[model samples]
Target chain A: MIRVVLLGAGNVAQHLYTALCNQTSVEVIQCYNRKGSKLHPDQKKELVTNTLTELVDADIYILAISDDAIEEVSSNLPFTNRLVVHTSGSVPMDTIHSSNRKGVFYPLQTFSKDKTVDFSTIPFCLEAENEKDYNLLKELGVTLSQKLYKISSQQRNALHVSAVFVNNFTNHLFSIGNDICSDNDIPFEILHPLIRETADKIATMNPDNAQTGPAIRNDHKTINRHIKFLSDTTQKELYQTLTKAIQSKYGKKL
Target chain B: MIRVVLLGAGNVAQHLYTALCNQTSVEVIQCYNRKGSKLHPDQKKELVTNTLTELVDADIYILAISDDAIEEVSSNLPFTNRLVVHTSGSVPMDTIHSSNRKGVFYPLQTFSKDKTVDFSTIPFCLEAENEKDYNLLKELGVTLSQKLYKISSQQRNALHVSAVFVNNFTNHLFSIGNDICSDNDIPFEILHPLIRETADKIATMNPDNAQTGPAIRNDHKTINRHIKFLSDTTQKELYQTLTKAIQSKYGKKL
Candidate 1:
């Protein structure tokens, strides 16, 4: 059995804890949070800790904390010379302290504390210092998901930025759509299917080929009309900036 | 039974043709395109016409052409005083020739000639001058889709603008993600599941509430790191602009 001491009680940490509990071959030896009250209520009191000194021996120690806290928490760990992996896309594996074997087990998905995500569909970006450590991380990754990527620190950094673009920026665009609908007294639900299909299209076709819009078509008349239609300055700015970006990418001149 | 004439030979017109051909109650009496070669290959020669004078009488005429052409084509039609609609999101219903009963039959989804979309999920945004014409358009809408909206020309205009943000801008964001992946030698497929989940999340939750990322979190350190990591000028500009936008939306001072 693979034993793990999970650090942090944030969204990713709780999600990881719940997913690991479902695996028959993996055991979460203990879950650590700065405040014991924040740990998952279902977790047994004996298997949870508020103090770093109380953490027990485990095959892997997964730090699923905030990016800013990662280095500090890893340096403060009581145990050493064991495998310690962080579930951060931005933080490097070397931030896990020199006393332990470093690795990364980043799950490339947006997480909410209240939402239960299906781990099977999430991509687990794994990284380790050696072949054995990589295989160990891969083993744990397979138990939770089939999509495992052995990414280097640099590659993972790039992936993290890309995630911000696709997930965060994409969601912001949806929010703008909602705002526009609200302004016009149109129900936001009307745009949901289009949003769903836009994402689904990319699953089968390249985004470059799948792109269709006034910007790509160089339909300056419609583009200008759209810009003039928007009352909000920021929305207009975003529309013009993104439109220009798409036009520049497609070699369409204004 | 309703007899119809479909105009234009573009993606939307072709999609509407294929969808309408499946209905037992509706018969597409004619397909009109300025260039005969542009008509769908499945359309029978007897039913296809390039000249406006050759257009036969039909219960409803759908000018599924460019926004600029809708006015000219409707005015140039051989017959008058019939239900004439243009399948444009931005174009107002009155853009059609005043001699004919004006209406809008916009299907609010991105269309590609090669991609086969599920018409059942597509939201058909219908508009007309009067109740009888609306019901006629709605009747045809019901044949192809379960979702229909009685949107006004003004509302449809706003919806069209919103569609650009959610579908077009969102797709551009995906292209940026793919570009970033390619730069790092990572397969773009790794981000596909995350992209799907991002869209899926908004289906249940408000995009404002569903938002997550360094920008939403106001993690200036990571944001700066990402901006520094990107070598492309346009990528950096987009990153900064979108980051500021999200931060502004969430009231996170940066």
Candidate 2:
């Protein structure tokens, strides 16, 4: 069994800790965080320490800290020869100390403290410097998740950007839709099924091919009508910009 | 059973036809299209007519034609004081001849020919001139769907705009994500779980509350890195516009 020491008490840390506890092949023996930040109440049974020097002996030290905190915490960690890894998508794995067997164990899925993730379905993106360390990390990932991908730092960076588009940008669009519905006195629940269906369709179909809109059809009358219907200036500008972009992509006149 | 005549053989027509056929209370006695358009081979057994004058007798007539074609077709249909309706979110119900009981039987969901929609779950937006016809249309909607909403033409127009945001705009963002993945030589499927989760989260949480990203956090370092990583001018502009929008909304600076 792999003994794991978790660092930080943030969303990712809590999620990783819970998922580790659920895994039969891995044990979270200890957890460390900055001073005054307590461990999860349920994890009090484990050796939780605020001081880096008090961290328990473990095969792997997993830093689930923020991007800016990686270097600072890695510099202060007690062990130099042990395997050190960080769970970050955008930050490079080597951002941790090179003295240790540096690796990354980034879970590509988003995590919230309140939302329990099904780790079996989550994709673990693994990276390491040496073959042995890489294999160890892969085995750990495979134990926690059904899907494991070996992605380079550069590729992880691209995936992070793409995640922003699909997750962040798409959420903003849903916000816009909710706003439009409220402004018109229509219940936002009416659009929920449609929103779910939109995401479901793209699972099997490419977004470019699944696109359906007045902009794609070049229906200027409908487009102009929608633009006029939008009450907020921000929404109007967004509609205009997106409509133009779609038109240009499809080789249609705006 | 309510005998119905469908006027058009397009995407909306095909979806509505299949949905009606699944219901025990509705019978599509005939389907009418323009002179040369090809009909569905499966629908060959049903009476198909090219001219409106040869329309079959039915209690309800549903015109599932385009917005522009609504007026032309409505002018040609021989109204027998029956309940006449058009399935368009944008077009007003009065666009059909006023000689009959006018109504709108718009299914507020995007329809693609190959995609089979769960009509029982789809929200049917109903509008009619009088109480009797409105109730009749609502009952017909209930026969095919469990969700029914009494929406005016004006409200339906707003919902259409909202649909564009959640459906059209969201799909474009997905396309952008796919493009970024392709350019970076990373498989686009990596972002699928995150995309699905984002949409799923908003179904339970409000979009504004669910928003998370570099823009929301005002992390200029990551934002700048992503901007520099993008290769195309159009994508760079899109990134800038969206980031600026997010920042403006949250009163965060980047």
Q: Candidate 2: where are CA atoms >4 Å away?
A: A36-39, A252-254, B35-46, B252-254
Per-residue CA lDDT of model 2 for B93-131, tens digit only, reads 888876777899988887888877778878889999999
User: Per-residue alpha-carbon lDDT of model 2 for A1-254, expressed as tens digits?
Assistant: 99898998899998788778888999988888875354566766547877888887788899998999998889887777889999999998878977777889999987866887888878888898888999999878887887888898999999898888889888998988888788889989899888988898888998899988899998999999999888777788888888887877777422
Worst window of 10 by summed lDDT in candidate 2 chain A: A36-45
Clashes (N, CA, C under 3 Å) per candidate: 0, 0
lDDT over C-alpha atoms for residue A72 of model 1: 92
Off by over 4 Å in 1: A252-254, B37-42, B252-254
Cα lDDT for residue A210, model 2?
Answer: 92
lDDT (Cα, tens digit) per residue for candidate 1, span B1-254: 88999999998998899889999999999988987643667778988889999988888899999999998998997777889999999998888989988999889888887888789998998998889999999999999998999999989988999999999999999999999999899999999989998999988999998888888887888999999999999989999999989988888433
Residue A75, candidate 2: C-alpha displacement in angstroms: 1.4
User: lDDT per residue, candidate 1, A64-135, as tens digits?
Assistant: 898889889889988788999999989988888998899999998888878888999999999999999999
